[model samples]
Target: MVELAGEILNLPIPPHDEVLPYSESCTDKSVHDLNADNVVLCRAGDDNQLGIILEIQREKDKRKRFSWPA
Candidate 1:
């Protein structure tokens, strides 16, 4: 997020420690062990903080790609 905050958004990165929940899931019960940079943003020790999902994807070369993600 330091990269995102500083490079992309040009904003200050929060000093608070980040908590990356292991296998954070929603209604679909999906997993990210093999896919996605599906991030949930939140400050530490705040259970009431509803995180927003930030899905980061890299563009694939269309010439070599066979399938696309949904």
Candidate 2:
């Protein structure tokens, strides 16, 4: 997964020991639920290396621009 992300996004992601699924919910003080489609956690031993959030948008939604940043 790390290699694939680096290749596809041209990211300089470091090597990780494990890849695991994470919580999709974002902590926000809002009434609406701000949840991503999926979240991934890259770990290098006991340290957390990176977090990747995957959101699949089938149609154009301007609201995503604001929500994604949160």
> Considering every candidate listed, which one attains the maximal TM-score?
2
Instruction: Output the worst ten-in-a-row residue range by lDDT, candidate 2.
Output: 25-34
* lDDT for each candidate structure: 0.47, 0.82
Give the runs in model 2 whose Cα sits over 4 Å from its true position.
Answer: none
TM-score of each: 0.33, 0.76
- Give the Cα error of residue 23 in candidate 2, in Å: 0.8
RMSD of each: 6.3, 2.1
In candidate 1, which residue ranges exceed 4 Å CA deviation?
Answer: 22-36, 47-53, 57-70
> Which pairs in model 1 have colliding backbones?
none
- In model 2, which residue pairs have backbone atoms overlapping below 3 Å? none
Q: What are the per-residue Cα lDDT tens digits for candidate 1 across 29-53?
A: 3553433345546565664233434
lDDT of 2 by residue, 4-70 (tens): 7678889888678899999998667866677888889999999999888877789898987676777
